[model samples]
Target: MPASLGLLRALVLLLLLLAFLDPKWPREGRVVYLLDFSPSAREGVFALAERLPREGIFLAFAERVERLPAPTARRLDLGERTDIQRAFLEALKLSPDRVVLVSDGLFPPLAPPFPLDALYVPPKPHVALSLLPPPYPLYGETVGVGVVLEAPRPAEARLRVEGPGGVWTRTLRVEGRKVLPYAFPLEGEAEVWAVAEGPWGRSEARLRLAPADRARALVLGDPALARYLEAQGFQVEEGPFRLPLEADLVAVGLGVLDLPEGAPEALRAYLHRGGGLLFTATPRGLFFGGWDRVLPEDLPLKPLGREGAALVLVLDVSGSMEGEKLSLAVAAALELIGTATPEDRVGVVVFASGHRVLFPPRPMTLQAKKEAQSLLLSLRAGGGTVLGGALREAVDLLKGVPGGRKGILVLTDGQVADDREALLALAAGAGAEVSAIALGQDADAPLLEALARRGGGRFYRAATPKELPRLFLREGQEVFRGGALEGRFPVEKAPHPLTEPFAFPPLEVLLPARAEPWAEVLLRSGERALLALGERGEGRVAALATDLSRSWRDFAGAAPFLGGLARYLAGAGRALALYAYPEGEGVRVVVLGRLEAPRLLAGGKETPLLPAGPGRFEGVARGEGVLLDGKRRIPLSLPLPGEWTPRDGEATLRAMAEATGGRLLSPEEAGRGVRRPLPLRPYLLLAALLLFLLERFLEARVPRGTLREGAPG
Candidate 1:
């Protein structure tokens, strides 16, 4: 053969030889397709499978292989609902190079099944942002909107607001693939239409403003009286008189004035609207008649005659009153004293830097009257004004004063102090009216007006002390008259059903009404007990007693003491009522009605039985079965096991099965009190075998090759 040709032929032969002994290069790229086979996911899975590459591995979740498509490189059909975590474990065994998840975004939180390089295929109509407050309070109050977005990566969207008002838009920058929060501040009582426009589509929400403030009022007289009705901070306005209108309260003063032209109609309207009216009038027949006509027929006002009532004159002799005011005040005090009855008590308080009680509370005898007159004449104005202190001291002197309606007539001529609230409190404590006589140019009219209102007394302006005498002596009549007998009774401690060692307070008794009363005594440790009072002759005595001066420091005068006494008389008759009871197993089951059965659930089955007596039950339980109509079956093996402890040893026996997972039952559940078979170990062993086979198969197929290897062989 020729050498060159032979060489060429040899080269060809060498190439053929090399081809015969060829080392195949491995295919490095992998294709992994994950299919979801959940009940609602079938259509999506089929669509994904149709679009998937035929040569790639196929994994179907929540369904078996017989239920899925063919032509898969490596097919894995999962039976039952897909466990995302288990699916990931199975996926790692296959060790695919490329991975894809095909389903709706609603998937369980699964461990990473594949590397980060894997591709994820999400289905369409992917809820970009879903607003979730449906059937919400819209257009009436506040509304909340929840936005949910579906995306593999974070999305930035804007919420475009549109409604009857106009268009306003705000941008929402979402960082992760989830729902985001945004709040809308809607003000006033207006309806707002809202729609959230995001990357996907628009979600609608409606917001309606709640009712603003609808509070109405009805004033009996001129709306001017409504102006004075400012205690609860309500806005006052004038309106025609109508009966059935929504007003808080009505004030009728100076009695001569008729209800406005529509006043009768307004009064009817007022009553229908739940209105309360306060009527103030002098004892004059003309004024009283006018005042009586305006009041509701149910509350008739009666007038008491002058001359038999107890009255105390309280005069303020501060430095601002160094002239004519002093003389008038002294005369007023003497005249007021002269009107008092022999049985009526009279006290005088003259205040300058501090208060000086001219005469302590004493009956109106000639000597007492004479002494009071002497004290009034000796009054000297020389110190700084402390009207609040004087008012307080005057009230203190009237403590235990003998009068149904006790009061102090005050005469002041300057802006003494700023303790009006304290004076009001002292007046309330004494339950006494404080009539004020403002004298001179320095007298504060507003302060006097407020003082009169707070003390439930009348305000009069007197230019000098001479006018003060007339003002004080003119209102010498009492509206109500009654004597108070004050005394204290000792209390003892007793056991209470709901509380321990219930202690009572020292109680006062009022005469003429034999009433039983009760009081709530609060202890230092935040516990409370009720103390009852028994009926006494002509009055009622509370079992609990406390010193009026010490325990009830806020209540100082006869009226307040009598009021407390009346309350005690009303509450002592009723016995304590049992509200609830305790039940078995440290469980406090409420006693709904009279329980005729035992309160305990007993026997091997914890059967509920009828109680033989109060809070006690009688029943039997044989085994582990709960009582149906007072009888229950007990599992045979429950009480037999050495490790099992019988809840009721006398009625139950514990037994153990040879199978590792079998549970011992009490004889009652066996029906015939016989032991039964429980096979659990077989299932456990079968599961173990399955796991071992799976591990072996995984070990045999997964990569054992090192990265240094050029290719997989």
Candidate 2:
């Protein structure tokens, strides 16, 4: 008992002394700080590292992680590209309390749910020129050059493009930013360069062009369609669907055809490797076929006969829209006049403080067109934006027009001071679809959107006066062409082989379009579907509302849109597309399409593929090869347009931060933490006092003999 009492006394004294001294200790766990060491991030990384917590912090560079001090003061040595998700996953494995990321905000799109601190480092003043070279250089075929510039906004830049044909240069007046597209006709195997000169400096890149291989396609229905493919330079093969041969694509027309044994397997293999298939069949033949499981039903058909249309153009001449806004409005009016067929009827209404009928509704005869053009040119801008008044006038004019199809096109800055609900009711009562355009940033976007919603028509936005005419032209074309009476399917978002490149916000089309149970919506404008895809037997099929020619012009000749559509039609089958590049000691194979099966073919031998995420596979290759899945072999080819281009990715990073409830910080404000006070001292002092009292009480209760014996051995 005596010994136990003494030990307890000593422990109490020690606790008291330690509590008074109050020594500081490091926090519970270390913080991991990840740094991006890409070429653009080097200079800023050193400065960023100094801002991190001084103690219990580990440093990690791209692809490699190690303890601090060992990695200190080293050059920003890392890979050319950065994989943020991979690095983050590695950091998570370390089990740190928090992870800090220092980068220039150029990360690929990441899904939701993660905890991270993103410290943005503004890139040094520099311009980067990224080019999209054509996948194949076909002689006499024109290919587009896509250029993206990353530099300080509002700076002058000169783009000089040189190819085999000659040199082309243009001085571009860039807004905060711009995407410049150009076209060049291919001649032969040649070296091409796209050089950009700006305030930051000069940046140039070289690309080598080679001739394209002639792709083979089989047409199984209309002989005319086969002839059309031949005209487009495809090596055409025509026969029944049972033709025993290999081809890159297949097109079918309306008819009942017999399927051959193993043909379905062959087609399924083709679609899996990113081949395309198209069908132009009658509605009856499309639904009631042997392809029930794969083919889409309830497909919309074009109208049997063309119908005339009546269109009313409502223009806003408000005082706020004086200079360029008025000019663009007049130009749009003229374009609408140009689109009117001889049988179409047109009218015009102009409104500022009040609305006036510039031209009453009438058949678009040669004389009527001349008078409407004259009235539009004579108009001038003034007063407030009375949108309701103008819409009422247009509805009145269109009420009695003779046609099943009728529409009202309103072009304005969208600023208004009128009864909003009344205007919408007028549009709905007239039974004419009302489509609206917001001319500039200051326009009342919400009101215009609501107007179009109630009227059951499309809504469009023009960021600048220059874009106004195009929007008007598209609107005019729709009205003059009879308002999509031949219904088109608007795209709804779904995962498919065709939607890989569609990253923009969903766009909505006015007309209501739908898909069958087997079909999936791939693209949308807002809420409306724009494109849909499905399968037929082993082949893929697609439907589009927008005319291909008009879409090309509107999208600045986007080749991928057409190519992706074709690939969807071809259907994704069981195969892999491998492109090998020499890396360090071995070769790296990139899975081009969604790698359905993991296998490769080289010199007629098959090998299993080891997956490295983001469509990469590491392998040892004896020579060039192709990707394979069972009997299907997808040949190695040049990268697609979707692969060659790099996205800026600023929006993606912001979204990730927002989704995780984290804050974004700049370099000046990164890595600093406010320490909370530790209250261990008071708790320690109180515990020691209690233990001393307990020892004293126990010693007092012990007998004298028992104390002498003390914990008997």
* Top TM-score model: 2
lDDT (10s digit) by residue, model 2, range 1-713 = 68789899999999898899885544454556777676556566666666666654555555454445532556645665556667777677777655667766654556533466677665545556665454333443455555555553345678888776578897875443345555664545667788988776787877676645444667664454455456455567776665444665675443222344344455555554455665433221222222221231323222223466788888888887788888878877776676565567888888888998898778877788788888888888889888787788788888778888788888778568887788777767868989888878888888888888888888998888877655765565556442332333333456764466564332222233345556676655444455566654444555443433223233422344444354334324312333444343235656544454656567788777776764445555544456564454554432221211233434555666666766666666564663334557787788898999999899889997898776567
Score candidate 1 by lDDT.
0.44
Task: Tell how far residue 289 is off in model 1, in angstroms.
Answer: 15
Off by over 4 Å in 2: 2-36, 45-79, 83-102, 108-119, 134-141, 150-155, 173-191, 215-713
**Candidate 1 — worst ten consecutive residues by lDDT sum?**
637-646
Each candidate structure's TM-score, on Cα atoms with residue i matched to residue i, is 0.26, 0.34
Residue 140, candidate 1: C-alpha displacement in angstroms: 82
lDDT of every model, 2 decimals: 0.44, 0.60
Per-residue CA lDDT of candidate 1, range 199-227, in tens? 64554555444432322334333333344
lDDT of 2 at 700: 84
